[model samples]
Target chain A: MAFAEFDLIDTYFSQRMEQRDDVELGIGDDGAVVTVDAGNQLVVVTDTMVAGVHFDQDTPARAIGHKVVAVNLSDLAAMGAEPTWISLALTLPSIDQDWLQGFTHGLREICEYYGCQLIGGDTTQGPLAVTVTAHGVLPHGSAIKRTGAKPGDWLYVTGTLGDAGLALAARQRRQQVSDAHYRRITDRLYFPSPRVALGQSLRGVASSAIDVSDGLLADLRHILKGSRVGAKISLDELPLSLALTETLTQDQALAYALTSGDDYELCFTVPESQRGVFDTLVAHTASKPVCIGRITNEAEALQLTLQGEPWQLPETNTGYEHFASPIEPSV
Target chain B: MAFAEFDLIDTYFSQRMEQRDDVELGIGDDGAVVTVDAGNQLVVVTDTMVAGVHFDQDTPARAIGHKVVAVNLSDLAAMGAEPTWISLALTLPSIDQDWLQGFTHGLREICEYYGCQLIGGDTTQGPLAVTVTAHGVLPHGSAIKRTGAKPGDWLYVTGTLGDAGLALAARQRRQQVSDAHYRRITDRLYFPSPRVALGQSLRGVASSAIDVSDGLLADLRHILKGSRVGAKISLDELPLSLALTETLTQDQALAYALTSGDDYELCFTVPESQRGVFDTLVAHTASKPVCIGRITNEAEALQLTLQGEPWQLPETNTGYEHFASPIEPSV
Candidate 1:
């Protein structure tokens, strides 16, 4: 409590980031002034994480900071925008120097990688919570939207799924895993990588896109509801991590892939005509884009199949709804 | 707790605001896409208010909602930007139908009045807090900054000061006031009007500008430090509302005017050359712009005088620092 707001910002945030030319005025101002490229439109996204709700005390402060920024940037990536600037409103119950150091370190690492500038924000004393508003820009008319999916579009997801869920299960003692596998899987939960480059490459190639934060089915529902289309996905086609597959049964792994959240991977649709182009674009990237389903004409209907046989979802079909229930540390 | 996040947004926020043309995609998207005018730059500011820290149980939910937006808009006003869009991150302990209704109603009223669109935000379950990030637009190179003041510039303020401070004093039982006076003063504390038009008008004329949210002298110190200039102000010229003057002794009112905060009025400086333009522009406005003092050659020094005699500031020179101490409801 002895740390003044100005000193806290100066010590932790102001000098930590590199300056950008687009930011006319950065921190230490009433409001930040930044220029958007002439031919680009601004994409804005905001996400908030509360200590006990979005995360728990067992979670590292560094991971908490990284996850907060990653979540917001994931939304920007879903819109196929290049990250540019971020403003963070951080509230803390008390100031712990070690916690502050770790948190800012995680924040700076992601920001440096994405080439985004920390413009300005507010810091207050209260229960721990972080609200980040990220700003990005894309060429005018190039933003991929949830409403743009077509009935004949093919569904694709970048990277593997269910690793975060598997990590959560192991941590909560619902499942046991080898030490090495636990480390790798827990990293997936703590340090989700926003598909920035993949999203940028998907702009014209993909018809519609969204990030897998609210589980694959729930997020796909958004695309279907907006585009007024249906989807039929193959369970066998789901990309699963080695750790997830090794730790859980086939059904449980598939269930986690289908219903659990916080993957932060890109789920998108590509028209059949552009399938080759999409394949060529993602061919060199580290993310393995896998085709899992196809859009259908039936509005708002989702069909699941396993090796050509009909399949059904688990009873807990509801995805992450903030106010519906408390979010346990394990997803 | 039964209300889903989507329902919470749709029922209270989605349909309430008028659609804006510049907002290409609004709520119900992974991210909101907005267009900044070709020749304009973006001004961004974020502010967070915590329940017990920023307000108390007695504070109305409507006032909380209004003040959050007002505070951010006040920052944009300081930058001489035209308010455009807002994103809110709201955390609540639990669902209260009446509180939500009043809060959203207040939010809608302010956004409608300011011509700002609510693009998107996150609603979560946690301790009660609200963080609002406001976006605005200004013509290229037109932003007025605190670093622009020069020695010999004249200092001026928009409207009266010390009203909010007096209201806080009355509410905390530190001062006594008539019922009518209390109502008038507390209204100042609850629903502060950001001087948007006045700020826009001063874009070219004012050398430096800042919103007085941390008392007059503390905010003025920012201008002085940034601009590397000093200032000499007349205590007799400090404008006090009739409600403030009627409730406290002259010295007590001056102390509040100098040290108390949450006024949201603009304190700015104008070089002698542009003084005529500033006076002429503000002549027709409701806010009576008053000249308080002049900038001095000494760097980072502030001098006070009353009727041409040197004066001393109150012992409590330190201003509001969020983490330095708790923000009582009255403040």
Candidate 2:
């Protein structure tokens, strides 16, 4: 007989989300059992990826699984929560054993690395889609919120930005570029690393922080809005890959860097007085966070300066949205 | 301008999942916040409903939303936990203004009834699908499990069965039945009252329990498999509705009660002495649970008897398996 949905779940989706001390019971029951620290609070977020929307039909199964799980983990990182468990709702048009095996392997790889367990979830037959809800725990009153920034808090971002956007733009054939540029851009697009440890390290050090999910300009503005602060972004300070610079003009590259999203990097604010210690803290990690701008008390307006000359970018709000449009419509 | 996904989120989904004391910060940022309660463990579960697979495409949007959330909440009820919050991931083919309004209204009605705040969720464009991830808290050592039943425990089910299965059978024909029968069966199918409070009350009382999303026979077998026990269900004692028995013969109705699935009732095992208390508890609630069988210390087998005459109800494993045969295919 062909594989039934029952067999598919038993064969693959039945494995534990992960094995953690907090998880009293894993998969195979009505729900999952988890023990949170005595004074810790739980952190939760949900994301849905629909085929033909978030991902095309032909995207590698491994990449789709990795991206879905990684994106949610990135949310927990922003909240300074230690990952604990995840529940997955998989909707498939049909039972594809090979696709499921690859998906599970990638999921297992990430869950094991994050010390989170697979809790309880359901699988059903429908149009291909994957919805993941990841849960984590944070010490009571210890989480970093977006509204904690103050004037004079120096802004920093971990690693690069525009690369993912450029990578996406190049893949869409928006404009022609050299093979080297195309390769670098697409690679970034396919595998944007989440800055988990860096976020955890910024627990008390960074006054305000949020993940760079939307392009830097829009996402950073969230911190500014939440903290009732404004910021001046030094366009010249944006980090660019050599290949990216070779493919597009400096201004064009800067546009993608400022506005293209999907980078899962941390854009945070640390007090200027703590700058010396912050620099020392970064020495322990290979992924160095770069200083980009400073938070200000001025009314909410984001200014960009290039070599002391002012530049204006489009005001269109971007990044992922979940209402009229599905998420990652162009992914 | 098109209804940008972000604007739609801001106008609707942003606050669909609410923030509570347990939730540090609500939506509109990188992620949401939920603090773990001290000494209480968190139970997580998710269920997805596709428009045509789980529910008819023409099903009322309000009821559809309510049922999707209720079905997931049923998982928590099976675990005997008090649901506190939920996140929804909805994938839609397109934006229908009235549908959105009705969907949210239904979602909010049930969420308020259960005291579960909507925390955060995502929306995507795809076939009509809705997934809900619900979280609940139980005392550290008190979460009821599905593997604790002993052979000598009594087999019991909460409320009536077969009504939902029959309702679907009728709905497929779109034939109108008596108002009373319609009220009774439609409630069974659409407004399944999950035994959350009842399940919680049985925490220390029930040996093992599972919500009857599948048929009672199929669900009870889950307990049997997990606890390594067998069961003898007294078919005559099964709870059936007058409306159900009117159109179908007693045997056919009994078979539907035993194997047609989708009742969303609770089937469980408890010591014989707890029967009086269980009955007493049901007398106080609108929904009444019924005792139908006894557990046996044998290898996995399910036997049904009528009027003291033993009959073999060989297991067909008739719970609605995702992607099983074409029978319970995704809506």
Candidate 3:
């Protein structure tokens, strides 16, 4: 027999998804509310994850839960907003108590780490999917936007990329990988740490920014489009992790890093004059920021290169899209 | 080939889910916002629908789109909120333009009619499920809750019930019915008008209230538990549609009416001394309210009677739940 609503909620989610702190009301309430910083404007974002589209069915529940919330928070981080509250709409094929518990446990862990509160949400029987609406706040006019970048801005990213894509490939192919490498890749896929502090620090500093949920090229194109400018990107400067270099050739690793999605590390632009200041800020903080390219005044379009040779990349976007199906596996 | 993200959004939802005055941004943006009356506190609710669970694949896409938002708005209506804005997240199997167009078209119609706006949401590829988060506002402290009922408060419901249940039965049995009756019954399942005006009108006047999404018995049990009271409900007073009464015996109709869910009407309690005022208010409204029973301060339980004899409704709620199997016929 399928689990009842009360049982599934109580056993899997009730304990894991309830509010903590002076947030007043929590789960079981029709609506939940908690006070935000009185001086800040609230920022809200929503994202949804669908089974087989967002993640394969073989994906672990906890990872799926963590990744869903992580991606949404990544939006807030990119906007330089402080994460505050979230609500979820979880739909499942059947009452899989174990899966629900795993999902909520991962979600709770992330929320607790990020100082976010779970306010409220709706649950219904459906094809497996999870939609999370997250709330954040930043001082009025302080939130970062893509339209802020200008000519001569230095483009940068935090940490390496493509480990997630490699991990996905390995998993899909059932390849035997070193446990350490597999762990590294899965961590990249599942637990993308939103650069919250780094973003908050960039508010008055960075010209414009966005998280790299899409491939670097696609996302940077968004910045270029929004800012009405062009860019001179250096493929050689693309940050590759030790894991990425160890497992693949430089060209292959560079290809994957340039186009891999799901790496929630931020890609931002700072005025060239502030480059020294940004370097100092990164030096002062635990998180390191890497300057990879520069924004240009010319509007000819993005020019990707390695040592000045024109670079080639995939014609389509990486990972899932709301409108389209996955690219046919080339491997 | 899978669809592209922009194409997916445009083909499925974009034109159909157009912007309204209340919307500061819509589908194309990172997030969306709707302004609320500063004097009124916001009431928010979310609900999800899955293709095989909450609805069948054969179900009209327009109905699915409309019902997704309608259910959440029903909660706000139960709270006496003025419907204002909504955000939607949809996951799909493959991008199907026709389905999306129909769905969004239906959704926009409701938004226009209810004076609400589409704010923002995320679209990702996945299995078929839709999640909608709706926001509304009501005068601070005037939004009725389910815990305020006291002894001697009269139980009332707006409109009739059980028609949707009969309609479902008819559909399953392939029974033909008159067009007018069919429209009325199907409307219960599809276009549930959230009692926003009536709920807002009853703001301080009604003692407590809830939306009749679950059967009256189960929903009343929720209020009784919250208020620490019992209720003596008269089955005879249950308002039944003429079509339902004409088709089924009183007992069968009463059973469906009492236990059937999906009646998106308001069920509330008002003090007896305010009967004249309540009556005046109801008589002036489009959805006429009917007295069904009285609240009694006692051990928590709900007792229903036809001519003062006992009647047992469904002990467990079977209306809808998250992560449960899809309704059998739908599957």
For candidate 1 chain A, which ten residues in a row score worst on lDDT?
Answer: A322-331
| The candidate that achieves the highest lDDT relative to the unseen native structure | 1
- How high a TM-score does candidate 2 get? 0.94
Q: Note the residue pairs that clash in candidate 1.
A: none
**True-structure lDDT of candidate 3:** 0.75
> What lDDT tens digits, residue by residue, belong to model 1 across residues A20-67?
899999999899999998999999999999987778788898998888
User: Tens digit of lDDT per residue, candidate 1, span B1-331?
Assistant: 4677778888989986957899999999899999998999999999998987877778788998889999999999999999999999999988888999989988889999999999999998888999999999999999999999999999998778878877877777878889998898888888889998888888999999999997898899999999999999998999988886887777777888887888999999999999888778888899878999999989999998988988775575556677655345332
Q: Candidate 1, A233: how far from true, in Å?
A: 0.4
Q: Count the backbone clashes (under 3 Å) in each candidate.
A: 0, 18, 5
Ranking by DockQ: 1, 2, 3
lDDT of 2 at A154: 92
- Pairs clashing within candidate 3: A124-B322, A323-B8, A324-B3, A325-B2, A325-B3
Where is model 3 chain A poorest over a 10-residue stretch in terms of lDDT?
A322-331
Q: A110-174, model 2: which lDDT tens digit per residue?
A: 88887877776888877788999998777777777889999889988888777877766666667
Model 3: chain A TM-score against the true structure: 0.90
So what's the TM-score on candidate 3?
A: 0.91
Residue B33 C-alpha lDDT in model 2: 76
